[model samples]
Target: LAEKSNSVVDNDSKRKIKDKGCIPGLPIDGLPVYTGKEVAEHQDPDKSVWIIFKAGVYDVTDFIQIHPGGRELLLGAGNSVEPFWKVYSQHHNQQVYRILESYRIGNLREEDRLKEDRTQDEMESLEFIPERDPLLLVHHEKPFNAETPANLLIQNYHTPNNIFFVRNHLSVPKVEEEDYSLEIEGIGLDRTYEFTLEEIKTLFPKHTVTSVIQCGGNRRNDLNKVEMVKGISWQLGAIGNTRWTGARLVDVLRYCNADLEHPEIKHVQFEGLDLDAKSEPYGASVSSVKAFDPLAEFLLAYEMNDEELPADHGYPIRLIAPGIVGARNVKWLAKIILADHESQSHWQQNDYKSFPSNKKQASPEEFAQAHAIQEMPIQSAICLPEDDQIVQIKWKRIDDQTKPFLDVAGYAWSGGGRSVIRVDVSIDGGKTWFDTELEQETPTKRSTTTFSWTLWKSEIPLDFNQLRNTGNQIEVICRAIDSSYNMQPARNEEIWNFRGLLNNSWHRINIKVV
Candidate 1:
């Protein structure tokens, strides 16, 4: 035996010391530290992979049974980065970096070393299957999965309570409407008042606004394929257009009985029920100008799609700031604070800011140097028959509403209150174009236009007898021009980011002409 050393292993001390020439033990740092890539490989066979993310030092032991995949996959790796980062990237924080540095010996791979070049054929031969992820709302009980389609979303005025997507950063508290009360803090007497849902209905003048709440990460999947990016793999469905009915937040601000001339007030803060790893609640803010603007269309919405709000969707009350990213739509009526400073929550001070293509995981000091992403860009998508298909087509006249026919429709909206002006549809391979019969007007401010999706129907021009004899291919393409004249980028590479977000490419569908 050569020697003995001391190292911390899973909170227990292990003793081992190694010498140079055939000695006993090596230092704790000499142990092979597993990376995210390694954890993924180990769990691929049986998903019960428990990887202790070396960075966050998180106690994921309890989450094993609750994991959607299975406990087996969450138990595979110990003290590793793969499973944790892969599943919890959105929850990553500064503390995680500190934990990683404490254990890292050095860079596992040397940058100067070069390996044999991979041929194009070799790279092309590799098979990759993307993981489907659940949607993470700032605060909710469960993250809603994204396999739903538009017709289903529009089946009713309001999405089903259970079917409604859940985006939460913390556990859903059992809040009772009768026992609930809203507290308004800032420049006036701090007061807590309670009201019944029915009392709120009769007390305040009811207003209705059709609005679309879209996630900032709506098209991020497209961004990710171009390059490694941060954030969620949100599909296009991160957006939903719904009718919101409530009292204007501006009205509430006035009712709070604050002095209008208060000079110290600079920002309006909104807090959600979401909590951090340390049980800190997530919060964010907007400028007092934006929050109090008469025309901002911000609402303390109590009803969605004309029904009682669902539990998954903030339940009794939630803030609805149309045209703003989903994060600002704080769920679970908590507290609204007017402050001389911005929100102190982790999300407001740390995340949701965009960076240049070259930056990655910059420090808070560095991020503050960049601008926050307040408004989303122009984007559109086709919800009819996706990219490839075999389908039964029933042709009918546009004037005949009674007949069922193949209808091509989709949703389009732009950030900063821009409206979709025109949508062009091409069914004959884009060789020629036809202006879709679009709705003549835009929806309410910050509201998603449902009928404007340009659900076009064309009678298969009875003149294709000759072409029908031979196998034919039908290619459909759709694009939108927004009020600001901004259009979707022609390719994904143009807007690629390290963190996959904002993937708005022209949606096309190809079908066999059966």
Candidate 2:
């Protein structure tokens, strides 16, 4: 027709290039180039949707509805998708990158390309994901929040790293281990101290601490059963036991020349590399007392289950504040501060706090007054039968009496190093109770307590008459007592809060007892 391009389009070359996620023939350079100004003009839905990933420009107008992130994909409509990808770490995979490449229309103009990308290689590196266990019960995918399945959770006293529960508030950071460093500073320190990953490994002695890391909202779903609450509907699987191997925090602080005894030093705040929209890293803090206490067993853990820490669980470095709620055990740790007061971060001041039942609205003044959740409450959960699972009644000797029974098993543990002492089961819904055989080891260290979880199993007598009265259905409820005899409440109504945190009420499940 009018004019044919000078460069001939090789059909085989085009097919191979297309398979590698690139255009065919535009000016014979393979793709058209557009400036940032041209791309910015397509923000309106009526025009088209253009987004940039690294130096590549993609037209995702047709892929909008099919995006796994749903409508949130529109967040990157007319700008760089880096911000969205930072919050949604799930997109950092080769498969996702290939899918994104399918919509590539052109390249960003070199003049308009990011200064940081111009000098880099054409290909972008993706993060490694080794903990994509199929057994995990995923609750959210954006930031990758998942829990261990109940049936698999109680099978091992020490949880496997691959199957361990993962809780992330922001995107999991992709930190290069070779360039990793920890910065320690604040008012309590004589001066700031920075340690490279190698220096930390060589400087401090490796200490193994067996502990249980549990989310404060471990049983938030139970509280939701009472009324509606605001948070991830986590079941009992939001906890796991692990043998963390790392350097003691007290030792690290001392090496940094921090004045542990300084009266002004009251809190130890931690910040992670994962950031939010404002580029602020995830932050939290714990009391200086717990940070320095020998019994507290604080650690700068780099290994989980005697292996290198998983990426989702905090690869290079993470805090292991035993007995404290998981929220305070910040992952992908970047900085630590010793100060006179607690961290002023959003998580510490507003989010992880629990409010009373009478408090209806989440007001700023009220959140400021409310204390942050540090040590988690005592908790236990049924693992064997599972909720809504059909269990067959078998004849067994329970409490030395031969009767129809259901084999029950679960896990229990308490915060502040409080060992789980006893577990009680009730088939009649708290009308009566039976003791369970607890499988736990006594603490060996003089100054330390058992920070690990307690595994308990029991056989509960099932009443056929009671099943008939309840329409062939029965409820299994359980509660645990800590070393201090702290027992869980019988009902979730007793501990219901607006945020639905610390739901340590009786762990219950309904099953068909036929």
Candidate 3:
């Protein structure tokens, strides 16, 4: 017992064992909590093909192979299908939800339900689910969070409005364009100001800025491999680049006689129209260092990708704070507050801040001391030659020698408007590396103002003669360097955290060069 127990699940152990982890369901209302062990105990196909999803435990023995996907549906017989839903979004529709509800025998326990599959406790804040593209992998419904596919993510410089990644904290607010209003008040303002959508657009000159908005939790899945982190198992798709057309936030604040740099103002809070069960709207803030910086390029954006903003993306209006984490770019922006301190919302105070990896639980005092996440760290990912893919080789026969190779491509970016200067690609993993050509949508500009992402692609030459010496597989890797010379950490454990925010580790994927 002095040496070690049979096993442990601390961060160190989880790091050595990198596995795809799932967030267990939490009890809603006063429902019972059932562990995975209990769910597994009921997994006899002849009796009940039990399944766990979100927090629901279902018995589908009567349905059997009658499912539309046939045996494919049984693949998740004894486990949670949350992972499967990441790539298979077709089954996330109302019909599927209803069918699963009919078979529900109980709930998947976290602390954890249930006469009802979900109740007001779980969805009182939710309005209605909006229709999303089947290609966009869904992480949560109701609020409707989803991400783009890796391949499609880089196909366009400005992601299409339809397929753009969404990270809504609550249901899309119902606000008609004519009645939409933005209220401004708090410490720095001379007086409270309220303006309609028309006044906001007509009163100020419209400006456009091409920028990238990425969820702070974008690469959380990578962190989960090291140790299970709490949050959506979001992969690399929770990011998008686009042109935002709106009035400059600086101009609007000045008009209200409250410049962000005012002596009394230390932070700028943005609140959303969508609210929680307690009627507390989604809220976040940026310090004056960011809010007051001219290079910050904060905007009261009404248009996305040159079109009117979609409802799922805060239609009437939203805050587009370049170089900052997406959470601070509040959607369905309802109010702007110039305050002496940061926003006092749950998201601002407790959730978004990064914590030490070793601490499994945090005290309230620890959360209060942590600063809000503003700038993102330098990062990159490999989209082409997906993990475990059978890579097809290409070569020039000028010398009659079959020199095979693989083409790799992906995106890179850094926060605080730091442009991605270079992307290093590797064919034999980190043992070798080569720089790739980068393509930027916006005109080349200063590193501190270049808020968009850089798409990089390269043809990594393969060593045909030595291809089969080690094995039939090739490990594709990428690490980006920002203009500030900040490079992504080489290993996930180097920056592992409990919340899994800001995981900008070197993105690596293994593929077969058969």
Candidates in order have lDDT scores of: 0.55, 0.80, 0.76
Q: Give every collision pair in model 2.
A: none
Tens-place lDDT digits, model 3, residues 1-514: 1012112224442332222122223323333345677766656666667777777666677665565334455667777765444324334443455556555454566443342234434544445556678899887874578999899988998889888998876667778888788999998666899999999889999999998999998988888888776677789999999999999998888888885556878888899998754467889998877777766789999999889988888878999999889888899999998888889887888678888878754566677787779888897988886777887787755477766667899999898888888899976658889979999855545544688999999988888555787576777789999878998889889888877789898998987776
lDDT per residue, candidate 2, 342-433, as tens digits? 99877787678887787644556667788989888788999999989888888976589878978999999999999898999998868899
- Ranking the candidates on lDDT from highest down gives 2, 3, 1
Ranking of candidates on TM-score, top first? 3, 2, 1
Residue pairs with colliding backbones in model 3 are: 32-112, 33-112, 34-109, 55-108
Worst 10 residues of 2 by lDDT: 1-10
lDDT of 1 by residue, 1-514 (tens): 1011121233221121111112211124434343434433434223333243322222233444433223333444443443233323563433334333333221122211111113323532442222222422322112323423544443443344444544554445556777776667886435644445565567778988766677777766566656656555665557766778888887776776765457888887887654433455667787777777666677888998888876657767788876677777888767788789888765665566766666545654655565555666776766665556665666565565434334566666666566777777666555665665544335655544332222232333422553375355566677778877998766677766544455666656666544
Whole-model lDDT, model 3: 0.76
TM-score (all chains, Cα) for each model? 0.66, 0.76, 0.77
In the order shown, the candidates' Cα RMSDs to the true structure are 13.2, 10.7, 11.8
Error of 1 at 491 (Å): 1.9
